[model samples]
Target: MDNDRAFMLSHTFLLKSVKPFGEGLWQPGASGAPWRSDAAEPTADDCVCSIAIFTEEPGTIDLDGTSVSLSKGSAIQLRSGGRFSVQSGSGSATGRLAGWLVEFFVFRFGDSRPIAGGFPLLPYHQEIAVHPFAALCSVVDRITRTADGYDDPTALRKQAALLELLALLMENQQRSHMLDNAAAAVKRAISYVRDHYTEPLTVEQLASIAGVGRWQFSELFRRLTGKRPLDYINTIRLNRAKELLLLTDDPLREIAQSVGFRDEYYFNRKFSRMFGCAPKSFARSGKTAASRQPLLPAAKQARVRSSLTGEPSRLVVCGGILGDVLSLGVKPLGAELAVMGRQVVYRDKLAGILDVGIGGDADTIAALQPDLVLLEKEGVAASHFQSAAAPVVSFRRTEDVTVRLRAIAALLGAEREADEWIARHEDAASSMWNRLRSRIGTGETATVLVQIGVQLFVMGNRGLAATLYHPRGFSSSEGAAKLAEGSERFREITAEQLPGYDGDRLFLLFSGDERSKREARQLTETSAWQSLHAFRSGNIHMTEAKWNYDDSLTRGQLLPVLPHILSSRI
Candidate 1:
């Protein structure tokens, strides 16, 4: 289809002047005014259009042979030569329909483009949303008020109002069309992922199928599915592997390869992290008892019984609580490091710690003969760690850093260290908030956005959110508050949702990954982002991606420097 002939009309039409022929408000019903003439009107040489807004109740209209149903706040247009009729209600029901109508022609200023040549096959019907519906109604009211004076001195103002109405209609149509296309494309991509999950896949390849940029594909995928593309793929692979572990006697390496994973060791680590138990252990207990009993070797079970003691000397950290454990002055034998290892806030303190990769390898952890194992509630299960022949203690990563710190301290017999860390953090936070009170409002709202890969998230009660949302400091925006109330640490959102979630102040969090930085820059350049109040007022701030981690070390580090970052912007 020609660009000018589609719902997204060309800019050339915008250059022409909108000249009104007639305008009126009418109701169609048993006793209401008639919309059509007694006889059918023939096509005219002049290119003209009739626009209508359904103000009350539902209605049906026939443009040529196509039937369109219009609900309240719906807008439609018809070309001069088209066969059209309007009636109240839909289908067999006869009811009342109230609306405003305007007939207009676009007069060319200088260019001689054929106005009648590009009328859309059938006019598009759009349902205006609450905000834009009011704007459209206000413009229509202006046109109605000025209809009588079209030939008088106020003609220019009336023409301008008509142009505004056209602009609003076009803008709404384009936005709605884009949103629909994006959603459909993402759905197609998801369907492809599920059908061909065993095949190798890449973001670029999936985006090609979706007909979108990789960055946009990533964001939309997360917004719609609540998981990153790779993560989702891994979930599929891991689930299939779990079923194989129960249904067959295949070796671990064969099972891993059959489910798209190339390395048996990598598969083992991910399996342990996701289900909290190794595949061998999960298989040993059978499907019925898997969750309840992750059996260990006889020797390891004996070792576990002997190690549940007053103080644990050797520790294996299997989750994010590594930071809290370190803060309490206890270093573990091994720890699961994040993918961005060099950027971790506590990287300097991990001098001799074994890098067990993310979610720690159960076999490697067990081989270390650790007396105790620390795991996160969301990560590798405590039973998995127990099967490693160590006393396992798990903490919810979403808990306040102080609470987690103290719990780790008590486990390690270092209560003094936990108290000192808490005291230091509290005093620093109080001092920072007090010093900047005059610079910031009493309850100035703030929102934190973090970019991971190409996905953007509204930080909830984790990471930088925990650091920023103190009673004496910045308050969470309405959108941020709602997200914090949920269990997820962050909520993925599209660019169009920025206005609703945006606050008085904005913080953009990005990781050291080049892709994440590029995504952040692209986000700031978008119209939705640039139009935000925080962006316009220069109240946007930056927090490194490392600081976005939900850990005691990151939270403690944010306390002192965050004041300077915000005060400088103010």
Candidate 2:
């Protein structure tokens, strides 16, 4: 129940390499060490966490006696005790091969174990290897330089950078795996549930689509995804029901049958449980509010028209990561807001956009003829904002429903609407907060970590309404530390170099395909995971990527159910 432990478990890290080695070379041994195929495999005593980026030279690798040839842009891993040997050419050519080797070692102290079939790490392949690798190198160089310049090598500043790198790597790997396995039969099952939730779907039917027996499919799905097929199916149906209730004027019974519920009474019961309100009440209240609101005033409508036709006013957004702006929701918001307001705009770069050559492009902004611009205060320089003619406003990102809505409202000139939205949102958020606060009651609070990729950034508890409910109080480990100094990119880390973050609660955000799922499963099953309080109490939660990244009305549809998922663990 230690709050510190809970906070640490919820943080994550990301690491990317800036200068990846060129293609066509054998995997180099440790730093300054040459390849030795005949060398004895390292034993458990010699095992350490290591991550390497190497280019294969159109040669074959002997994987535990099975020969598998690797292609360029392939990422390969070397486990603590697992041994693999690679030869340079198809037949004869040996000597010194061409290519570069960048190795990252992650060292975790105290009890640590590998995940995913003992091959805890995998290669991330991009169609063009140059960009992703280059991004990684940039992140690594920045982190290393920052760490070196610190007056104290083991200073809190260095730890923060290292944590962020870890979260970033974990998220990158998870996301890549998710994309790769999006077409798998298991994923097909998920898609089917999403598309046909309105229709009755039995376990047998879902299992057929997944190409497995009902029992086997159920077990496998739960093991890989942390939720049973039936639970996931019901969750989807309930989500759709909520959407229809909010967006449409359909009657309660009709909406109930539309989402596969057999009876209106049963639907109302379930809806109230999920959303803390009955369907009829929710719909009626929402309708009343909409009916009461007045349309845009004549003067305001004229101003909007004038702004569109005359000199466009520039709008600038600041203080968010690169990924925040590049997300599907944010991107469309930018375009729609721009068209509506008629102005030049600037936005922060989050995730991979910085490396995609989109940051600070003057020509692109010029073509849009925007008078205003938005940029992340932390990610962009003062010189970058000097050219903008419009006002630049800075805002912070947080989980607090009120803060986020207010920020968006202020930006879009819809503060009154934002206030209404906040009130409704607060009604739900506040109730949950009260329930959580009563349970915590000056007792030790649980620490939680949220994994991104290799970077281990902590979520801010101060701005999060949920934490306020806990009487014992909660805080982020990174709250007092200085922001990690680096370019906006993924950083690299060896498994051995990862820090020990045993906490009371663990929330994982996996970003890759089936491989990443397997890795996460392996991590969960390990002895290290079992030893943690969160693991023992079953307080771990895996959130959907769409829910985590998408910031549209769709997100609102999912928000009410979050407290149920998190609080159920307690």
Candidate 3:
């Protein structure tokens, strides 16, 4: 790699926003309505990394053959050689889309040494913490202010800051380390791919499932699991193909296409490479037969059906956010209940009690007289629900969806319902995952900054803090977690404090009342916030105050909205 090329490659440019290069920067489309670039493909030498921040202006880009409308605060990093065009449309109803963009050159030393490929994006296996966006803006401001007289000292400072920013981005984008969390992400991704494989499964969509960036995710996945990202994806696709081959006796070409393979020959070759036999041979050998066993036995299946269609049934759901309770309760035959106070005991002999909050007192357990009680969170005890004459079911609140479901089902004498619910939800979640996988088959993944109340958290290996963005994806950021937690206060920091805060998109959460809205407005007005790319581009979202002290179902409420929020932002 040339020294300059290497230097560029070594330095990652964080883009907070992009606007046409012109004055009226604050005005949407002030540079001119977005238009397609008629220029031919430019050489690497002809391209330079340029980051710009802008308000949300309607804009379109022809990516490959598809036209993608760029939402406000949406950041894009382009290689010098890539050819693209942009056209502007009407601004968002809120007026201007706010955000900033920072462009840094990438130097490819040579084909043999890819700067990113050579470095492990995340060395640690923990959740990524969200860095304040203000810190990123400060770095960009400093660099731009001294651009005319770029001295050695300035260059050195810039280099160091850039490196720190990259480090932070990598840290925030690391996948959750916990096996269950990782498995959930994988399962969700698979579901998405299966559901929308007919569309496109870009790398960006997959990263959305894993809640990380395309590049960082690629590195992390490779480091943790010994397979390349695409290789792993193909493995999943092939497995599905094998299943189809055995189950339905679908034609080889149809099965290949159904699983995302465009060419039958290529699919067969790839299948042979991985499984040591052609698709036909594998199907004939009953390899796929082994994959088709009902996840549960006949008895279990019958039980599940009975539970779903049974008489006015009782559901003991535990360990979900308050929104989950509301969603579940509103459903027919769904009675939402929570154990209050501490020290609830389960006698195991009595029937379960579903306490539905009479006034604010869960003490009504004694008044209602039930068989079992379910408790969640800390500070609630078994003795509280003992008087209700029932067994108490208690479990830790985490991402262990199966364990949580099992506990709840046992209490309600609806173990079969729990199984069926899990099966159904898992199946639904899986289908969604497959659709996403197919959509962004291998596109670039964006870096995201999630803001909670006072602190910013990142997506790490534990996956505890990751939240799904609605319509299509998930994001790992401190802010996102904090929002999920429904925090009221947030840390106020300068842009300089957050280094890699540049290229990532920002998702802001706020309490619903007028006061929270006022605070959100105040935060947006701050110089630090304005400087950060997401704020300037209107990428910042004022999320509903779903998870407050009074409302404990934050996770439940946020999960469904996640995909929608993410899709809108994109």
Candidate 4:
């Protein structure tokens, strides 16, 4: 933030021939070999600092015991008193290392004069872009070419070249720093919006929170959220108003004020524009639906919070694991709405939660400033969430549902809830299975067959198979168990192989697409399908194909439904 200081390079020496000594303003050092396995590599000194630029096939630099890869056109700025060595004999066709080492001290202009600002260092392995690299290499060439003689003009030429090199480094540093600052500012501003949307807000205030000018802040905000600051704020307000319309019976004026709207007139216009109806009309429609019956189980009211903060912890679910977190009685701040062509069974429970797309990215997650991020392993990279400056815990979507629930609860600091929920689920499952024993015997084998288009796969350890194959309920057929031995969730097989995997009971699922449904009907008519013991005995249960998840929420919802499905078949 200070504008009083500017960086400069001073006391320059080119270490080409011999190691330089004393404080020579423009001294060309004695002959020395380039950094390589066969040469004497440079080491850090408490009294000196240096920058090394490599141009040939690169090697690794061991700085203070950390191996850093050196690429062509990349530079390393060495700090004082760190051990430095280069590993040689790889990465180049000629097996030679070509690099230039420039030793200098950094100074800052203070009070209209130069002051020592210590030896400023760049990152350990910063790669210089092509244009800058060429510019830097050209300056280095000029410095080296002019430094051979010790005359006054020759020294001036070397100093001029060094000054240009320093300018290039400083400019790059400033540009990089500006970009980083912009991202951090946008993140902070968006977080402020989330935490304080109900209060008075202004573009200038938000920009101030980001520590940048208003224009810059707006540009960065739109880049991340695809909307101007005012537009985004309106979106959050409108969504909250929608939730209130369904969950409470407050008047339009009161609801508008509660969600930061200036008055009912503005709220009415915005609501009408966004949802294609006036506020009162939308509420009437919702009330009519509720009169018929509660559309969904009321969302858990008690929010999950951090023990450290006591206030509800802002959370983001970046993968299909939203169901796991929801099962633990924690509604995340944001979640992926759906996956695999079906909405989550508890989609109605996602009121007031932002849809963070299918898989979240660094900028969006960072903007939320969540206390923690719950991510699923598939289709998400844990590193991306880590860069959001939040703690991230990843779970495999296909892992045991109980294991995933416990892990998520632990991340949320809600272990007791997970334990209690699992106990209750087990009890419910036991009761459901017990009631079905009269029609479906224990230890009877079952297989899940799924038809999507022309392909058929046996559900192995994942999806419905996870719900069906319980010690007290049913077991997988021998062939299905063999398929489950592999790591994949399902295995594709031909119709001829269907009989081998057939069991005493079958759960036949087909995709909802018209083509897949037609294929399923065709498969059912084939002799291979008609010969199956389950099919012949009328034990085949047809269910919606998309209910193939093993998340805790899905499993809980299915416990009561499974009995109805089995009994209907009987």
Candidate 5:
């Protein structure tokens, strides 16, 4: 379809300006520029509606506080009395924005007005593929090309075209609804929440997991579960808390953070609401969680017992626990070392360490014949290692990671060193925050972005983003919060969500993986990548994956280097 011909009659929807069913100057506007729309305020007396179609490049439409991306061939419903603007995908001259726009006003004809409980329409600002594209083109062409545009024949023709378009939209919306239902996208999101409920969760992150919009996901979840997403997450946490209360004797505060609730008072209230009493009262009642109970009685129950008199006299580290042990100044006698993969970050620091290959090569472990073995409780370390040459200990999974590190330190006779290191880390973070706080101010936000393969992840509280969220550190950007505070440490977001992560500064982590690096390079070339606030302000910096995450040694090393990265932004 020719954009010029379609747009010439585009003014006053249904081709040509006419207030056929209403008493207002219905106007149609067309835009094909590669730029952002200025913020427009809606008039109180006039209620307007329009449909915008992407013709060239996709851009984001900010309606009120919500941001949604519109892709090519996709259209969105625009209503009056709401905050609205169309933002270019990026600032580059190439890949400029071009789209079809139609706007109309309804001032009421007599007592006529739009019907109430109107078809349970979709939430505002959401984009959808318009089906029957050929039919819509036909209708628009007929209405606009007519020589007698304002005659009775023209009016009748316009009304019919309007109805046809409405029908097509209704049909298209249903198709989208059915797809969402069949996918059970909300159910998948619920599972992600249940698993990672311990981390701070946001609706955006959950919706992304489910491959749906945040608004639609919330609505469908409420319809299916009869509760809000946050309410459901709380229920899951409470149930886990109940099981812990019955099975273990961990403290209430510890249990609270363990289950994802950061506030004890809030946890107590929700617990009472769900189980009819406080966490303590629930635990004291000796009530077992009915659902998590084992189906069959056990023939034998085994416990992980320690045979060591003290920390292993000679330590052999295995698996991903390399960073934790290395942080305490204890050199592992033998560890899984490699040039790529998990050990890549620690390569330069761990030069001469005996390469044990991957965690537990029974032959290698036996060959090292170390006095003690420190390993994770899940894999080889958790397995029966009686046949190995050394005694093994597994780190307990808990809310406080430092607890395990401290235990290891005690065994290695580096208690003072560990304490000193902790003090140094804390002091350095505090000093840096204090020095930068005056310039950045409180609530100034920053976001850390990570790309692996073709996927882009917003790094959450588990990495450098977490360190920056110190007491005096910078606040997380709105979009960044969805990932940083959510269940997953990293979340994949659509290009439209880039604005949500927009802030004063952005940290991009490159792991030196060819696929990810290649994709990352391609991303920077797009208009969407060029248009970012950080990119425009020159506040985006390239760094390694290790510095952006929550690993202690990596973060400690990063504390000093980060100031230099932010020097320009500050």
Candidate 6:
């Protein structure tokens, strides 16, 4: 990589009031609004030429040798790769005061810099005047109303109005327009390629997404991202493929198709060139894209890149999703996983790893020096470690465990481990099915009953029910289904309704609390409990009271003893 591309740096948003403009998703030709944000500092930009028009001032943009005051109605322009440290005091809208002072991130692509007029624009961070500011505001308001969501006539109107504003601004000596109104066009297209890379991606399709001509989008995308349109698509696809290569045992053809390379051979050649090694070798050795990335960046900076030492890299997991990544056999930098209700008992698996509290201080986390920081959600307190030291990711819990599992697998460079575990699980599950198929038929109904002190509950997709019956296709009793219908996991019920929840098979899950145990022992002895056919006919089983929580680690443990427990041996 060239020095310009390799050493390139950008500013990031620390805090912003900029919601998704124009229909909640950013696309080309859509207009943006003036935003009131509280970004204390910056590390990267939105990969665009930014126009910061300050309507109010509480922030200071720090430069190498000086500081720039973001005074009222003053505007500053920053290009791609420009870095600035700013502190905005969450501006206000009280009585004649503007709620937001800045409207930023416009005219992104470099092609727009050479305007039709010889406008020099103002010096960077020197605070310049913007004439006809109200006219600029009117054009932006029209854009918000005009651009709906696609390549329609409304979008044309929005784009035209925005271009008119750009042209007017370019006429000013302090500000010049770049590429007419195609400022954010290329960045939007690049973002589309990143998000939807798995789909059928072509230059023409991306251009359409950007609302630009095929040739125009192609040329501009190359200039901004430093790769051809198709090449950029391939970069995303094969990068994901490398993850799957390490994470899944699926066939090459299937992996290829999954990552958008229908032809396995073509993918193989590209992978070889990109990584300097074949796919199989890479997976077996757990080689990452870092084997070919600029070593200085990954080594010198903490940007969530992998280590070449041939093992899962050290990680820092913040939030409750610790179990998801832990189940992949990847040890994190922290001491132990966070303790939520009922999950404290499963902490033994984190034997070698140190246990860190969920609310660890920011300084302590930075001292641990994790390579990647995984947040359960975007609002995790651990996000403070997102500096030049480590990359912080918010891995939200998705509907599918495979999506979550595969993503974490790639991140930790545990693809082989993941693939092996998955294959082993499939085999065990299949064997279990074959063993019980003769005994448990398709017509059989299974229901999980929970006892916690005086609380009687029914289980749904969360606890043992998801493992025992959801994938196994066991039917829920009429009452059990009805009881769990309103809840995603467990629903508490009255003791009088326990008999109605009984199915062909009954599993007793306890909360393990003292009150639950005492109440359960007393209740099971009652005639009301013994009246159920499943309870009296040797079809009832006792399950681990504490393993009812959802997570990959707990689920993996359940798979091993599942058949034995189902046979009433437990």
TM for every model, in the order presented, reads 0.45, 0.33, 0.37, 0.44, 0.44, 0.42
Q: Give the TM-score of candidate 2.
A: 0.33
Once fitted onto the true fold, the runs of candidate 6 whose alpha carbons sit more than 4 angstroms away are: 1-305, 308-313, 335-348, 358-364, 377-389, 470-473, 478-487, 496-501, 511-518, 526-533
Specify the highest-TM-score model's number: 1
lDDT of 3 at 351: 29
Q: How many clashes does each candidate structure show, in the order listed?
A: 1, 96, 120, 5, 13, 21
* Candidate 6: RMSD to truth: 28.7
lDDT of 6 by residue, 378-445 (tens): 34443466451666555443223444566666565566666556545544554455434434656678
| lDDT tens digits by residue: candidate 4, 395-422 | 5555556656765665566778887787
Q: What is the per-residue lDDT of model 1 for residues 1-570, given as tens digits with 9 covering 90 to 100?
A: 465454434333321222222222222111322223433332222355557666654555666656555665667765444455666542222434356556554434554433542234324444443236688768866766635445754665666777787777766777767766986897788778766888899899999999999888998776555468998789878876876675467899999999999889999999999877889997775443322333344566555434433233367887677778777767677888756358777788888888776677778888888877777756356676655776676655655566567656655667687766865675566556644543466778999988777677888878877877865678999999888766568888888888988899998988866777667777788898889999888787765778887777777877767854663341
Query: lDDT tens string, model 3, 1-570?
Result: 265345545544432233333223232222332123534433322334433333334344443444444443233433332344444432222323334434443444443211221223333212222334455455545544445685778677766665665554443444224434655565556556545664546777787888765776665554433355577568667766755664455688888887888888988899998766788876665422212433234565455335433332322323332223232222212223343211111112112334455321445445544333444544556565555554444443332344444433433345565545544554554444433332221321223333445544332212212333322343434443343344322334444554344424555555455766566667667677778666555555445434222221333334445444544541
- Which sections of candidate 2 miss by over 4 Å? 1-360, 385-388, 396-408, 432-444, 452-503, 545-558, 567-570
> Model-by-model lDDT, in order?
0.67, 0.43, 0.44, 0.65, 0.60, 0.56
Residue 408 in candidate 2 has what lDDT? 43
Q: What is the lDDT of residue 480 in candidate 4?
A: 83
- For residue 494, what is the lDDT in candidate 5? 72
Q: Candidate 5 lDDT (Cα, whole model)?
A: 0.60
Residue 562 lDDT (model 2): 53
